[model samples]
Target: MTSADVTRPSPGRETPATAAWRPSRVVTVPPAVPPVTTGTLADLVLDWEREDPGAVCFSRRDATGAWRTAGVAEFAARAREVAAGLVAAGVRPGDRVGLVSRTRYEWTVVDAACWFAGAVSVPVYDTSSPEQVAWVLSDSGAVVCVVETAAHAAVLEDVRAQVPALRHSWVIDDGGLDELVAAGRGVGEDALRAARAGSGPGTTATIVYTSGSTGRPKGCVLTHGNFVDLAANAHAVMPDMLDEPGASTLLFIPLAHVLARFVEVLCLSVRIPLAFAPDSRELVADLQSFRPSFVLAVPRVFQKVHAAAGHKAASGGRVRAALFARAEATAVAYSRALDAGGPGARLRAQHAVFDRLVYGKLRATLGGRLTRAVSGGASLGEHLGHFFRGVGLTVFEGWGLTETAAPACVTRPGDLRIGTVGLPLPGTEVGLAEDGEVLVRGIGVFREYLNRPEETAAAFRDGWFRTGDLGSLDEVGNLSITGRAKEIVVTAAGKNVAPAPLEDRLRTHPLISQAVVVGDERPYVACLLTLDEQALAAWGQLHGRPGLDLATAAGDAAVQAELQRAVDSANTSVSRAESIRRFRVLGQDLSLENGCLTPSLKVRRSEVLRVFAADLEALYR
Candidate 1:
């Protein structure tokens, strides 16, 4: 496609102009729900309690591994009690209360409680280090902190001196929530009502810090309206997924992340039963036990599921592996045929056989009732997208950042497209700059960065917020992210290369965990790779070499050949100039512990380049 061709969507399939919009450069979707002019996030719980006291909104696992359910009335009463506790403890209106916890029942209650008390909540990731904890607390000026564990409380103690505003801390594992409830026994009902009524839709709700893939994490100031309006609009557009009877979800992603945080409110707004899996080690068990109808996760999680299935099949022996491979290929073909009209009779038969033999088991792994999933944070790529849909789980890819209050655009259920991240949400407009940078303006868009007026001003151009990510809109207005403009690598020969597509493709392979494509000023494209330890162990055992370590496997002939095939497959998608010419497999994997990956799992590209400089230089030599 020529430059002009790539700039515009297909000839006649343009989306209706809702703004003074251009064909591909800009597109807008009219709001399906009316703008939220009144009410705070606190009211979502309170209104439910008043109207549907017996409605089941949350399900949680107890210490004995039993699942327990909570109704709207119980949840509302608990939130009120927690809010009263905060008030009794001197947490005044608009005060910042820090919450450091994993995804759990109490985390949601605390989030609601903060809003009930008319306070702004600051969520800190449980995995965050002491320094990160210090920065967020000190910067946000949190007056009180509620941590999930004694270890986290200890981390807070280390930073207590730095954050002079933080006067007290509570540890939930030690019955801190119970203590809070007890302390608030004498608090008046009128005080709780007044606190809940103090804030309107425009009042600040939370200060969510960016995952910081590049620089220091900045606090994104999201308002009550951003969550309330966005959730209402999202529900309006996707009622089949959100408003259906028995619609439920299992949230394993960290609640500190903006996407999961928004999902917390989205589920509450729609009155869907939401469950949390705080420990990843227990995620599979949780999925099976909770049996959610729909779920949400990043693309990496989907990729891991697919890879694990493949590895499991391989472990069962060659014949089983071949049958599974054929089943996977048939699934991809069947899904593609669906887009081309419908599957043929023979393809249908093949899919039916596989659904009975292989697909059913895979679906059972995620809970037999899981018919749909929502993917964000990164691209799912067309390969995994089709395979999962083919296997009976439709994964909807969404696109957004912390500044957008989660989703600016998300694929709809019936109108789904495999490769693209669907149209802008209702009340949202998306545009591409001349350089292909994505710009967004919507109900979900955040107000500003905390205490960074100049940076906030620079983040917006005119009225649309500059997303800094390159993307293109398709014929049907589905948005496909190309790459981050900042991460683009220009070769020594002056050819521009977008590494994300290639890296995403490489990660689809079972043995690869992370792929960092580097060649900014080098002769040609090259890559620094890290292996998936779990997949590596499984792959090694299947290859007659048990007890394999990353360092030894980096030079293993079989490993090199397998990775080479994966690389060669990725190279087929790009021009010879942009293709990866060489790659180095590191002895160690990049991780959050080493500061190479953000909490959201995006690679710190500059960090990778710095830490692996010698590897890149060796690739050229």
Candidate 2:
């Protein structure tokens, strides 16, 4: 396709100008109920004693986390001991215990202890800012905190004295524990034991903080029933998800995310083993070494890895690139044909070519024995969405927030739908407010947002939590999220634009690694671009120019020409009004350290606009 022929959805497909918004058919939800009497995550943990008494339930990324021959029988002992310690240290049942740790063996231990003691485990994202972390501790009214590294411990030190409810902090010692121990007020081992030995089901399992990409974080108070219900429901929804008792996953995302916590509970519920990967360096290697059966990653990973492999293949002479390109095309065609559910001749012809070149490597990238790769946190671009499932890995797209106790909707194996975060999981009732806000309720609904009772009352009305997402559910009950209620931009011409779709399209260009559309009140739409480092370097080399530093490269006339071409290509499929008339290529990556992004990598819109005010003015100058 030429620069003017970028693949844009049809003109009338989803433009906000002509949107005929309809609420979700909330009544079309699937039916479900609790399977057993396991009142909570701890109750589920204890159940494993009857099933697999000697399987490894959890493992740290390091040698310390791996226990070759211990399962629930051992897990129960440790959790009970820890709960008893908490009690001995004065943590009462129902008190919130803040876990400011990375994904580790102790995370599960403390979480289970909270469940057993009828206390709440408040997970603090290891990457949260000091202010953010302090908010969680204060808001949740936590008494004890379980920290991971010294860095985390240090961040909490100054605030430790400020949070009146905080009495003690404990650190897991794989590497960064001393600082935590040093900062802690002090808790005896017997206290930990007493805390662990305390209660079950009907307890508040956790008060997980949501990733506050846009605003201040809210604490989602989930009960033991909320978690256990989801786990059992996940099993009922897809019984064969675990081939064996010890299925594994490499945990890289911050454990504070509902997705990560859900996977942890899955490990306890199904007797699967989860290996932690707290550091970025260990992520890929751990994936290969652990050979995990399942992988859950954001779209960023899928895009970057696929792009890198393509670059590598391109470097191997023209013949290799063309071969791989043709194979990909063939594979997509074959996959689509078969996906349409037919024994068609065209499908057979296409698959024959696809298998010889792409399937093997594709399978290897997914850890070889992969069953499915689950994606969430953001809406994945359409092309990448289809590309993953098209490559033979059963990619399941899901939708949820911390308030939902993990996921509310998921695309399971036999019920797969490529572009959408599929049907609502059993018991989640999805509805639409007058303003296109998606509201959800049911067993998965959180009890409340910590401390902010007024905010909590506003979010929940007549038993529904306004999701703040703008989306519509289709005939089959699958949701298609267009944008956020707050995130949508309104042009001066009164055109409502969902920036995610346009941003997704623009970022697909290798040269433009990240972008944010800006037309909220402007006459025409525009965007700010963050250049891809590798792609910029490659472009420099290809054009016979010495690669400059990021700022110099972004300002380079030649580099600007390349990005302009990319912008032109990105605009081809959209309407003139929606097209970006101009843009400024950013010199530096948007990051949290510099106050451009949140800890979770979401752009701080006001901060970015503030920092780049001159450049933004230059767009129209």
Candidate 3:
């Protein structure tokens, strides 16, 4: 069947918008899944263990580069042992346990063990500062924190006295897992089972903190039922991506993020083997070694991959660079034609030729086995989506929040729409407010924001959880996100503009790395641009300049001219009022360490504006 056939929802019922001012009606797409009444995530794991005791559950690479595999029974046993340790350490039912680490095997074991011990897991990003670490620990009242390395332990230790609730911290790199298991050896299996049994649908599973672009992070309270519903519906919608017996995923995204956490649980529920890459810098090598069937990453990862591939080809030689350019154009054309209906005869022939000559090599870089990929956390540019599809990798872009337990709406395998985030997952309802703000209501929605009842109440209008994202739904129920409600810039003339689409477009340029559009309360729209260092250096070499640094390049007339072309191209997609009339290239790129970008690589607009206030003002002057 075609993508249109897969995305078109059966018309049976309609959900009316709650607000009188809302012109867009609610879109309710019936779930493809049967009713899931799983009591807790632990129960789902146990069920899988009973059904397939010998099924390989996880594959982790050791320090020596050797791959270690674990089966369902083995992982469950280890989780129980870890749960016993938590219990032995005074982790009673309903206690809050904090996990601070990069994505790793131990993190998953500790998470499952928390559920097994009837404690709630609270994840803090590994890159968080000591102050942020203390704030999350104090706010969540997490009693025990498990850290990955001595460095992570040190960060927590610096603020340990400030957080009285954090009684103990364990470093996984220092044999913490073995020590915990040994400490709990006396604890019986029956006690662990009892802890798991105490959990129900409403029981709190995790407290994931928001990235806090604007202010302090707030804890989102997600329940066991929330995760179960999301995983079931997500798997139901994309069975081919998850349900096959040999389906596996190499998860490299931060588990602190709800999206990666959901993938972790979903893999367990469907008996799919899950693997973790220790460092994102090694993700390419890991993908080559593991050769996973599917992968999940943020848009930034895809963008980097696309850029790296282009740079590699261009650096090879003139002949190779020309072939790469022709291949990219052909791929975009072929994928766009398929989206329209199907490729014409000539387009199909051209695609087949590229499939052997160009696309196959590109696919090989991703291990030559990735059937599909999922991009979330931010919007994936439509150009990249189409290009990837042309190269034989279909990326299904999804949309959700930390509050939705990861995914509320996602594009299914064959239902790929390049721009839209596809249809809402089964059992979820999406509505657009009068002003085009997206509203979501479903079982996957979080119960509340921890210790913030007023804020929680404000988050919901009537029953629907206000997503604070602006978007619209097509007649067929596909969702297209415009921008965050709070991020929309209101020009001095009163015209509102969404910067995401423009920023996304500009980043696609070879030279542009990051773009932040600013025009709030100003006469016209302007932008702060950051150059892609590698791309710029390569461009400079191809031209005349060489050995160029970012500072020098930022002021160079030639560099400014190239940026102007990119800005003009981006402006073509929007109206004059919304277009960026001018831009200033910043000498330094925004980075996580610099506090200008979030750990997920999302630009912190407030922080950017604060840091570049003078540059922005000079543009208008």
Candidate 4:
């Protein structure tokens, strides 16, 4: 974790792009930190205990809603005890164990314990249904499963007969971990060391299932070297953020996600004190209490925060609302100025005034300490990125998928590219296929999709792994994702269109929650829209239509006019043939509960097209 560890590009290595006009097709960054050759992930815990025994490594909320800290020595001791329990229970090296839970301190302990015991940890989402649990457990052949509650256990019980390999299940809420610790008292330290020594950097560390936004979830085989090497390289490339004085982060994203899981190991490697928000409902309250210096979240979370601030200002009366609007414009302008030299004196003065009024309050809402964040899972709108930076919070947007073990490319705070996903990390190579498909090759990429040899072979061509995403690299190697190749729409006239740009622009409007543009095999492009409940309510109250229901609002002329204006603005970004021609507003928002969105907040386009087939047909009619 020092500047000396970073490796610059070798002499004569061609830069990815350099033309003053068009972008390039390939980008490669040399390894910032050398790949780990011998040690396993378990060695990270052992090193922490031996070197920084008393350093705080994690924090958790107590029963009374207060923050509590745990040091490296204690964390390691707990993990060793749990590892002994697994060894005593007939678990051996390479055995698969299931972990089903929300983001919490215990999840990390169990994860480390699994590594220490030379077992492969399989993470199942806490919100998974019985069928999903069965599919993952059966597919991975997990022998032991740990669940957070009785409800989660019940779901497992419903499909226990289907998973013949499962031998035991434990409930965290009922003190299952304590019982295991008590049962392992007789196991000697020699056995624990032997178990840990069985694994190396090449050994399998975990099998994480995909979010299944399109089809059945697949188990991805991630080796210990993937985490170890990627963590070192990521830290080396972004030392400014990861090595900042008193740097710490609160992780609210599900542990089952590759991004959050990677951050878990990165925090431990860099000795950054990490905290978790088990329940998203209490995230705001927890932020106030924990006061973390940084955070990791998806783009939707930022959108909600901005929407909430706008709603709050509108509630404070018309004059306050107008002032807030002016302040917001000043902030965006101020941030844009930073890219073009610096802000003018008058603009800087205006920003200074807003810092005392609007900006400070916005920062305080996310815990007064938050100065940096890492956004992924989807493209964060350019305006939101600039707005946050203007208000004193800098968000670094990154891009990657489950196959790449989290981020392969990330924006650097020092260079500050507002629109693009950013440069490839050290040791990562990004290129485009002839058809514009994104290809990746790096230490972070997964070895294979578990138990799918045919599929695994198909996933890689020559050397790079196909990402199924389309993107472009700028003149300086910054990557900007355009859309998903499989999700592209084609009209009857054979004109191709990417729906992502239109959808992203529409979602930026306060009244719009989700948008799906459709025109495949049809005469023209059309769209299906869902209104944001919170924003709609505020808009209704301001227009003398308080307590308006969604059905009534859908037909209201004023609401229709506002949405049309938004649609018109979005259309300006593309050609007339690609622009949305007609639209139908849905009666409700597309959400995870409604089966229109996935656990990672990505829209299930196929599901949307199926459920709203009639609405789409009406647009053409």
Candidate 5:
């Protein structure tokens, strides 16, 4: 209910220009959310248990790859037992419980049980380093931590001595869940119910940490009402995609990310059967086996799918490669035509031909039942979005931040926009500050950054949360994100450039895995490019340069020429001032372990620059 003062500036302003950027006209979507009166996530789960006790609520792959399902009643029973266990273990109301695990059945059980026990759940990415784990556990003041494996537990153990608040660590692989349940066997059902009843809209449900691409991670305090409102609004907006009978999604993105977390909660609240894949490597197999109706993934997943299809087709020989190329062209053209209005007879006929030969095969890789997907965490390239839509799988791109508790704006199925992130979610207001920074005010927005009141105050201007993302709204309200406001580079010539569009386009090149455009105060725009190891090897083989590694390929004139073509194509979309004039191909790839990329896969520009300072300096020289 509190609003930050909009008329004044706050601390931690990244740039002086933040105060100088002109605010764009206010853009607000028509309110379409029905009144959300859901009390809490635990309340929703209990409601489903009573309403449809026999309906399937969750499914996970067994050791032999068979899906094991749990019904609403069964799920509720297990969660209550876990809640009782937490109570027996001395976890009290409002206590913080850390969940350090992959996306799996136990993670869900513990998450739901946390709510049932009136405790706050804080998730640490399964891939996080010990220092990150320690930071989150300590910062959130978590008393107990649940980890997926002994290795995960070890990471926490290494940091346990540093985190004074953490008192217990349980490893799921070592019969941790069973132990908790057994410990609670003596606790009464009334006590579990009392714990569940203690939670309400005002209580913090979770503190989701940001991916920390720019700095140390900050925990965003999202309340029960935040999740309730987000789920209700999202369901109301995309009922056909999310609320249909037997609707399910194969969740593979780390649940530590807010986007994935929102989808998990949304599926539960809407009574949609939820399936879990251990990781991205197993995702394709799981999708093929589960045949989910829709999927929600980061843009990288889609890019990989697209790249794999291209590689597979090209490897089939010249005749097949030519046919695949034609099909892809037809798909892109047909999709563009449809977005312009609707496909014409000729375009429709072309699409029909490809649907049988190329599109159908690609869909089968996703298990043949997928009709829609949601891409977020970063920009789903405009061309890729159209290509997928053309191939019978419509990807509705949405945009949000960890602070927004998931989606603030999403493209609706009916009003699909190829390049835009669609309209703001119903009940969410979207506006632009003078500097073109996106501003959002909605029920889904988080209350604060846990224990970082000054940072929290600085994040909000008036009642709207400063998204710090530069974007625009179309005439009908479709939102197109341009770039990160803080990431804009001003060259020595005083020309401003947004790196995301260029970087996104560069990554579309099969040979390039990651691209970071630099030249903030330099003479011209340049980039540091990292090769995709698989793509590099494949390209090398195709070009009769077999056995060439990434390091060798980076210096190969032929490979450089091929990459230059991609850079040229990307440059065509922008003015000369913003064009990438030169680039350095780095032999090594940016990764989370190296601290060059965030857990969500965003490049850490500063880290990348620091590590490759000499290589980057060589470019301008």
Candidate 6:
């Protein structure tokens, strides 16, 4: 059964947040996914492995300077054996299995086994506090928990006494799986039969938690129908992207996030290899090893790569730097001119010049095989987006939340808009509320937040899921996300402003890093910024302000003023009411572990409210 079989469309509604952006004429929806084959996702893995051996499905870097991987067929067989081990340990169908770990080889093995053994996967962020972990363990009613490292083991053990449902806790990579799986030796009758019995498309597959940028994280339960169809729909949009039989997707982003997990399943189902990046530090080498055709990453990765290229270009004399700058912008403009539908001989000549001089160098750093990059997780700086596209990289921005199964609208590969987040996926319905919030509905949409029926009911009126994001659709069907409804800051003068646009402007300044605007119920916009460590390092050398580290640089009067200048200059582009009048430089950088950022690297507003309560009060002082 598909999601269509599980829920019916809501009745016609009168009032709604989004008025529904009706196309001038109805466009055909994308194809609904093919029916899911029986026997679960594990079956897909086994089938691929049997076909190819050197084909590595999952690989990672070890701390001792080497890469690791499991064979295409070996990977599946291990998961089968792992499932047998779990069943012997008392795991049963409909059981909730918590994967409490960072992305690693063992994490994949255990997670895959959970699904094949007829268990529900509960993926939690690795940085979660002990108390938060306990809450998830109890809330999800998990029967088995897979701990990543010794650190995770300690955390889970602290709460195991309180969580009675947690019967079997396996510490992956702790030197135990080999012996345990051997003891189970071959598939047990009960678990093997149970695994073969299988589940329908509508059965619960996983419960993914949102990054909780708005408040405490809420769990969104997605079934086989919600996710399997999304994977198949993704294939339909760019059918040729994953055509190579031995293709691999380098898994770096945290699997706890819905986007990464969904991509993992899609790759497996489509018969592509999955090479897990060894660790965060070894990502570059991992990328080179796999030579991925497509990569899904956040904007931060592109920003860092872009910054590195700029530094390389600046190494030459003043004349060389100026020439490179002129060449780069000309290339960007030339490319844009072509994308506008018509092209000229003069534009082609300019493009050829930059392609030889600058774009070639940048492409080498990216390993040269990357065809398209899909950026999501948060709003990308518009200027940064333009910079990447200009450098000859086609970056497609997609829109969705954990609640929508991670995607509602994605810009098509052939047709892309630099500033907008592409068109709605085929087979999905996207419209704007009368008030302008994005509303989405279709087979790809999730059933509801796990157990919050009231919130679910409130979220839907006439079948549309309220996105809480504000934006308008262009004539060609691209989505432009302008701001969030809840984050609108009002000044003492009663003028309202959306921080995202202003924040984007501020980020364009080379010295400024993360800009978190604080003006809600206040007189004007104020911000807390994390200075770009690399840029600040360069600035110190140029200005003779010596500081070896970021913290020391933060206190250097000259460095502090340089950061202030970037902020002040960005403020100049906005109206007086929306501009930041006063700000403070933070000595300590905002971090995920410190409760300053979400797992996706977005600033946590409530945490900012608490940690910087004194700094915020001083703005009004």
Best by lDDT: 1
Rank ordering of all candidates by lDDT, starting from the highest: 1, 4, 3, 5, 6, 2
Which has the higher lDDT value, candidate number 1 or candidate number 4?
A: 1
The runs of at least 3 residues in candidate 1 whose Cα sits more than 4 Å from the true structure, single-residue gaps closed, are: 1-24
**TM-score result, candidate 1:** 0.95
Cα lDDT tens digits, model 6, 1-621, are 012111223212222445553322221244446545444665667677777756667666667756676777778778777877777777777788888777767777877777777778999888888877887777788888887778999999988887888887777768546644865676665656666476756677888877888766777878776676677777777665677545557778888888888778887777676767636676776677667777887766776676666555544445555666677677567656756875488777777788788887677666677756788877776667766776777778888888777877777766767778877676676677677788777656777776678988898746667888888877766778988888878877888887887787676665666778888888778887776776666555555554535778656777667667877777777787788887777666678867888887877877877987887787788
* Poorest lDDT segment (10 consecutive residues) of candidate 1: 4-13
Candidate 5 backbone collisions, by pair: 6-462, 21-434, 21-435, 22-434, 22-435, 23-433, 23-434
Residue 179 CA displacement from its true place in model 6, Å: 4.9
lDDT of 3 by residue, 359-409 (tens): 998889888889699999999989999999999899999999998888888
Please, what's the RMSD in Å of model 3? 3.2
Between candidates 3 and 6, name the one with more favorable lDDT.
Answer: 3
What tens digits encode model 1's per-residue C-alpha lDDT throughout 411-527? Answer: 887788888999888878888887899988768888899999999999876666888899998877788999999999999999999999999899888899899999998899999
Global CA lDDT of candidate 3, please?
A: 0.86
Cα distance off (Å), candidate 3, residue 8: 20
Count of backbone collisions within predicted model 1:
0
Candidates 2 and 6 compared: the better one by TM-score is 6
**What's the C-alpha lDDT at position 93 in model 5?**
88
Q: Residues 1-621, candidate 5: write the lDDT tens digits.
A: 111223332211222334454246555544455435546888888899988899998999888879999998998889888878888999988899999998998999999999888899999999988888999999999999899999998888889887899877788999998889999999887887787676677678999999988889999999888888778778888888886766888888888889888988998878799898887787788999999999988898998898888777756655666787788888889888886778999888888988898999999999999999999989998888888988989999999999988898888877787789988787677778877889887678888999999999999876678988999877776889999988999999999999989988988777888899999899999999988877666666667787778868777999889889999999998999999999889979998878898878777888999999998899899
TM-score of each: 0.95, 0.87, 0.95, 0.95, 0.95, 0.88
Question: Among all windows of ten consecutive residues in candidate 4, which has the lowest summed lDDT?
Answer: 4-13
Native-to-model Cα distance after best TM-score fit, residue 121 in candidate 3, in Å:
0.4
RMSD of each: 4.1, 7.5, 3.2, 4.0, 4.2, 4.4
Candidate-wise lDDT, in order: 0.88, 0.70, 0.86, 0.87, 0.85, 0.72
Where does candidate 6 stray beyond 4 Å?
1-28, 32-39, 46-55, 62-69, 186-190, 196-198, 244-246, 311-331, 341-357, 548-576
